[model samples]
Target chain A: MSPTCKLTYFDAMGIGEPIRFLLCYGKIQFEDIRFDFEKWPSMKPSTPYGKVPLLEIDGKKMHQSAAICRYLGKKLGLAGANDWESAQIDMAVDTITDLRLKVTEYYWEPEETTKQKKKETLLNETLPFYMEKLDALVKENGGYLVAGKLSWGDFFFAGVSDYMDCVVQFDITKDHPNLAALKKKIRELPAIKEWISKRPKTTL
Target chain B: MSPTCKLTYFDAMGIGEPIRFLLCYGKIQFEDIRFDFEKWPSMKPSTPYGKVPLLEIDGKKMHQSAAICRYLGKKLGLAGANDWESAQIDMAVDTITDLRLKVTEYYWEPEETTKQKKKETLLNETLPFYMEKLDALVKENGGYLVAGKLSWGDFFFAGVSDYMDCVVQFDITKDHPNLAALKKKIRELPAIKEWISKRPKTTL
Candidate 1:
């Protein structure tokens, strides 16, 4: 067995939750390290980019949640075997990440005018566009995002859909039948369902 | 031989440059596709996220510059072989990406108050901090980002440092000796140098 992993983040789910879910579902033992706001100042300097979701494998620390998740996926044999599948998986995850970043900008905007504009753009343009593409990809790939198998990208997409539903007040899956079916299928996976049920609740 | 690859983006050496460099350096045959502002609106809707730097492999389209770069890296044997090395490469690339996004925000802020605040935070807190860590990592990993060989992460970092030097009035590599050395090393590579010389020059 490999050395145990340690993940550091704030108490909230935010960027770190998907990684936590992957680890738990893979049955990998890891330390779920958390920090309070008061402690972040001291902790900030120690991280690569002074951000959370740093992963410690054995004794060496690695930062970036996407990188961490990819590493865990490879380690757990969740990433596909060949180059094409790996590329496809990376593509799908990157798409989800792109959507998530837009959502992040909505939260970070301080002015009501800019925030409203962003929200309008998201609601009117971004949301439906991504939903349509995701739905199409799901259908094209035989109900999976890549290689027609359960890969990390599927989980990442499911997580993003769940987040959008929670934060954007949009019933993402409901609007896109394929996406809705994909989410339901992912949730019904025995290991994933068990992991979701047993995992600690997080406030993002 | 594989079918010809075509990449489309703005004429500038922005996000599209990395994929261009990777493909050219790897001796992969690809069409260097570019466009101006007049073409962007009509072209935008065709993109997956209404963004550029899309790659067409064997006539199949792919979006997201990072994902395209990673896919090309794998095709060109630029990404590391094993899980650990691949993770290190990905982590480094992702860290650079994080900093780039923050830097982009500086340009996008419309308010002077917010812009000033972002500039101060970035220069005083974020910039030097990331440089120091990157310098240490480059040194620790034997002058390459992963497993002592030139990986896609090295190119990604070089592209970032080059962009900072071009756009921002600050000397990004001067403060960090290892980072400066790494950049120089990447620049000195024959294939990279040749590709750089031949690359289309444009203002982003």
Candidate 2:
């Protein structure tokens, strides 16, 4: 049976975007609900973990965006070919997550001086190190993040790297040919391309 | 052939303990390598992600503690009964990870003043809310974090929550009856009990 699905998040390509990309890639339809930050306080009380990117399946809500992606990846056959492959996929996704948290740590800083310091650390040291390593991984895996096949890791990296690129406000992939190609490849997919064409745009 | 495994992290339980607990739960043998902070900078360059909790399998190294846990969960037949249950397991583990990170953010702060303030926020707001919710989740699932069966999520939580309890310098389970019971149930298991009996004790 086709389960009713709804995804709720702030109107931005934060963690929510990857889940959206995964659903679309699988040709699954869901109610994509987004609201402004002003609406979050009231909405927070209803969320499972007081966080966005919640997935409601047939009215039963579940939290954690990465977990959701993994579950749906399995159901959609985007997980991996086998358990070992799944681990590889998981490893790739999580490495990206660590990189994401570095930026989020900066975002959550309330002090301007501390925030600037974090931004410098992210740009000067963290970003180059992680991006370069990941680019090499993609190349090693024959242009995908793992197993020489398209998995949730690819969708995850493709989704979050877009946000990372926007925040860094530069062509993050300019120096890495394979990662640039990965972005273009994922972006050009029929489902993702269509979703991106119509999805709400904001300066995330 | 069974692959040889080596798990490396600091001498503290920290993230490595959960992975250790999972392996021990399965009665899987591994080389546990622990180091001190003084030795980390030199070791960092060789690590896959420049982080600890590195798992080396048959000479190939990989990173990400949670991902490593998931892989071992499957291999040990402690993941879940099926895809849906595995999703629930993933959800539980990731949710606990979210809670753990809130505590780690404070742990990473270099400023004593900032650390104390963060500790206050954790004590007054974060710990109570999350522990209460997790307690409820455990009760709802009938004394386990996910399925009624023992899974890696249980081991992960049992291991990390111990560190959380120590860092907060109190028994966080003091008020959460279900979580307390869950912890007791896991800790008393034959393998976990045996591992705890012999593992090195650290302040963290």
Candidate 3:
């Protein structure tokens, strides 16, 4: 039998959404446990690294969003065909994550002056640089993120795109047609569509 | 036959050493290409995402340090015995990466006052919290990072520990005996020892 799975995270979609996407893509039934800032202090100590987006499979708690995504991707046949292919997928996922983090660092900056500077760099420099490269990848790979076919990297990027947009106050898909199409394709998948429609709504 | 391999990174260890360790552990001979800061401007445009630690195997250049390390680890039979074990190792590696980044943020801070504040928290809170948790993990897993056996995560931690310590000006092993022993075990491995003795020397 499939092990009982439960994923815990904040109500808003951040890193948690990618993991949720993977589970939904695989059609795996899991308890979507969400909480808020008020409950975080009490819950932090129980976590392995005081971070959420934790996955409990058969009562074994697992942390780190990337690791959990790869595990599920591998189990569900969404990683790749072999080690080399999986490596390509992993590289793409990491790249997407790198770009995501660049946006987030600025988004969460406390001081207004520093935050504005970061935002300027992110918009004028970082975002365009990454978006162009990623657009080329999607176009070259026939509309998928890596390995020329659907993989968890695609799910991951699609899942986090909304949060990224909200954080940056910009539509990442703005001139990146290939990436926009890829996101649309992934979102339209039956399982993902169902999950998106029912998942808790949040601004970010 | 093993595919011809080449690793290109800065003259420093930083993120490149773990991949080097994996290749050496498996006795896979490859070209180790090191470059200086002056050469980076010209080289940056050639990289996938304007980063170093690029690994080229059979003319296929792959970027992303974590992805390259995982690929090498899997090929070298050091990733894990199975999917679940690989996931466990990935978690440990990611967790270590998180702590490493925390130290780096403060270490690279330009303002003295902010840097000092970050250092205070790091030394008083961040370092101890992560070190204690990681130490317990190594002890429980019997001198390895995960799955109760040697894995790529062990190599990654050992390989990066010196850089991390140098940046933060602290001996992480001082209070974490189990982690210390684990590092010793990895460094003393015949292959890793040979690599360490012969590898390029750098402060970080």
Candidate 4:
């Protein structure tokens, strides 16, 4: 029998969404448990490392979104065909993570003036720098993120794209045709399409 | 013959050290190319993704420190015994990364008052929170970060511990005996000990 799977996170398409995408893509059944921000203070201490997007497989809990996604990717046969390919996938995902951290920094800036300055830098410089490189990579890899095929790295970007845009308040993929196309392709996958259609809607 | 390997990074431990530790631990000889900050402006553009700690194996370059370390970890047989074990190692490494980010945030804060505030919180709350948990984990896992044996996670933490201490202005492992012991053990390994003695000294 399949191991019982439960995922707990806030009710938003943040880091947790990538794991959800992978589970759905692999046709795995999981209980998705989401809570509001108000409950986080009480919930935080109980977490393994005081963070969210936790996955429990067969009563064994694990933290870290990227780690969980990678685990599932390997299990689902979407990680890579071999070690080198997996490394390429990891590199792509880490690059995506680097860009996401910038957006997060801007989002979490408390002061308006500082936030605006970060916003300008992000939109004009950082986004383009990353998107262009990522675009060229996808184009070279035949519309996928790494190793010339679909991997968890693709799902990671697709899963996090909406939350990132919501935080940055911009269409991050506006000019990056390849990134936009990749997102479209992932969203159009049968399981992912169904998951998106049924997943709970949240402001961010 | 071993692939011609080249690693390029700034002349400090930083993220580059983990890869160095892995290579040295595996006894693989490679070119360690270090550069001063003044040269980075011109050098950045030449990097695979405009970052350092870039590893080129047989002329194929890769980016992202964690990704590179993972790749090297797998190749050097320090990753894990199997898929689940690798996932556990990834989780531990990611958790360590989370704490490192907190230290980095405190280190990079510019305003004195804000920096002091962050420092107080870090020392009083964040450090203890993570250290206690990690100390317990190391104890449980037989003085290693994951899987009751040595892994890249150990190399990663040991390699970065000094840099982390330099940034935080605290001996992070002072009270964590298991963590301290793990670092000492990794450092005392023959190749790692040799690498440490021969490595270029820098203030970080």
Candidate 5:
């Protein structure tokens, strides 16, 4: 019997979306509980870490997005074939996370001067640096993040890039054709495709 | 025979130190390459992720401090006994990382006003929130971060808290007595104790 799974996150395709996408791709059934931003203030006190994207497996709740993803990735046979390959995939996922945090900081900056400065840096420096590096990795790794095949890192990065796109409001994929293609490929997967068709729409 | 390992990072006990502590605790011999801040600009471009704490297994390099730590944690039998326990450990490690990044942002913030604001939040809210949660985990898990015995999460958090302390200049553990005990227990391990005695000291 499959384990009962439930996920809680704010109503947006933020970090929580990756876990949803992964579960959908694995054909695993889970309750997707999304709430509005206003609800988070009250909900915060009840969360596992006062954070969203909490996953309940067999009634036991777990926090940490990457950890939940890794567990699901391992369970779904999407992590990697062996320990070394798993480490490589983990490296790629964390690298994408590093890139995500950098981008998110720009989105979260409250002051106008700092926000403009960060946007310039993101557009000119940070995006180019990470895009070039990761684009090359995708090209070299046979269109996937690691081991020349599909892994959780691919889905994770693909989901993260969507959030990045929302933050930057620029066609980030224009330069990184390979990564763009990879994202398209991930979206085209049967399970993911179906989920995308049915999943709730949100501006973010 | 064991694999030949070489670790390259700046001449500081920052990200690289955890990798060292893990390797030392496992009694794993590795070449520790430390360079000063002056060398980083020239060195950065060659790194796997353009970041330090690069672990070279044999001759191939891998990046991402958490990924490297996870890899070393697995190889050293410090990950956990099984996948479930491993997931729990991963959860704890990533939570600490989230805490670390939040604290480090204060250290990295350049604008005086922003820095002061972040510092105020750190002192009044953030540190206490994480410390209480994690300290409870240590106490509940029988004196370790996960499981009843030592795990990599213990060492990783202990290492990270030292970095956190360097950034905040506060005795974060003064109120969280259990976490303080956990840190002490991790430090008292023979290998880590020896490494601490001999390793070059850096403020951060």
Candidate 6:
């Protein structure tokens, strides 16, 4: 029997986008469950940690976007074959999520002063640090983040970098040529490109 | 040849403790490397993402405590058995880390007014939400966070809850009785109990 997979999240790109992208690109059949903000309070109670992006598979619920992504990645053959490579994929994806959360802080800060400080920190401190590391990893693994193929990490980085460019008003790859190239390469993938173009456009 | 691992951080029970606990409890032999605050600037360059709790495995380096913990957890059979249970464990551990990071904000705010507001939010919003959810998960999984076994999520929660009790100046499990019991149960594990007793006591 095909497993029942339903993704619960608001109609935004926040955490749900990666899952959507992965499933769509892989042609995996699952429900793209979105919720109205008005319904979240009641819906929140059912979630594992009172957060969305919960994946219900075969009557079991799981939370955490990274965990959900990894599960889907493994199921879809996007994660690597062995434990070490899988850990490396997890490391890369988790790093992207960390950087994305930092960018989110720019939106969460109350005033111009705090937001400005955060923006500056992002530009000067956080972005370069992550970009350089990503560049090194891409270079080390021969342009892919994992095991010489397009693993979930590549898709995650592509999604995150795209979101960062759209939200943070900074060109992430301007300085890091290799990371820029990596994003471009992932974007050029036939299945990924098709999925990106045809995918539902939502504000997360 | 056995791979050698070295973990470097400040000699405190702050961010580095969870990784240390995982390493020790898993019986994985690794160097418990520490550094003085005075020497951090010089030390930061050697780290990826310019952060500590950096793990050097057989001459290769990896950063991010959660990533390291998850890697070691999988390596030592502490994560979970299959894809789904592993995802649940990851979700729980990451949620606790999220809550812990938010709690850290109480200390970082420079102004007393902001700190007070953050403290209030911590008390009213964050703590109860996480406590209730963790309590539910513990109860649902039959007194364990994941896989009906003592996974790293249990230890991660124990470390975070212990930190909350000691550092955040709040008894997290006061309302959540199941969470309180799970914490007690985790604390009484022979390996964890022995490690907790021998673990160097420090204030963050």
Model 5 chain B weakest lDDT span, ten residues long: B57-66
Question: Measured with DockQ on alpha carbons, how good is candidate 6?
Answer: 0.73
| Top candidate, metric lDDT | 4
Q: Is the docking of candidate 1 incorrect, acceptable, medium or high quality?
A: medium
Per-residue lDDT over A1-204 for candidate 2, one digit per residue giving the tens place of the 0 to 100 score: 554899988888988888999999987789888899889889998887788788987456677888889988888898999877898988888889999989777877789998999999999999889889999999999999888888888888888887887787887788888889998899999999999999998766
Across residues B92-164, which tens digit of lDDT does each residue of candidate 1 receive? 8888888887777775688899899998988887788788888888889888877888898888888766666
Candidate 4 lDDT over B52-168, as tens digits, reads: 889987467788888888988988888999878898889988888888888888987998998999999989999899999999999999999887999999999987787788887
Give the residue spans of candidate 6 off by over 4 A.
A1-4, A35-46, B1-3, B58-60
Share of native interface contacts recovered by each model: 0.89, 0.92, 0.94, 0.97, 0.78, 0.81
Every candidate's TM-score, chain A alone: 0.88, 0.95, 0.95, 0.95, 0.95, 0.86
Pairs that collide in candidate 4 are none
Model 1: per-residue Cα lDDT over A79-192, one tens digit each: 888876887888888888888888878866788998999999988888888888888988898888887777878777776666666567667778788778778887787777
Considering chain A alone, report the TM-score of candidate 4 relative to the true chain A.
0.95
**lDDT for each residue of candidate 3 in B126-177, tens digit (9 for 90 to 100):** 8899999999999889888887888889989987887787887677888899
Better model by DockQ, 1 or 3? 3
> What is the lDDT, from 0 to 100, of the residue A154 in candidate 6?
83
**lDDT, candidate 4, A24-97, per-residue tens:** 99988998999998999999999989999999975667889899999989888889998788988999998888
Candidate 5 regions with alpha-carbon error over 4 angstroms: A1-3, B1-3
Q: Report the TM-score of candidate 2, chain A only.
A: 0.95
The reply for model 2, stretches above 4 Å from the true place, is A1-3, B1-3, B58-60
* TM-score (all chains, Cα) for each model: 0.91, 0.96, 0.96, 0.96, 0.96, 0.91
Residue A91 deviation, candidate 5, in Å? 0.5
Which number leads on DockQ? 3
Positional deviation of residue A188's Cα in model 3 after best superposition, in angstroms: 0.4
* Each model's backbone clash number: 0, 0, 0, 0, 0, 2
Model 4: CA > 4 A from native: A1-3, B1-3
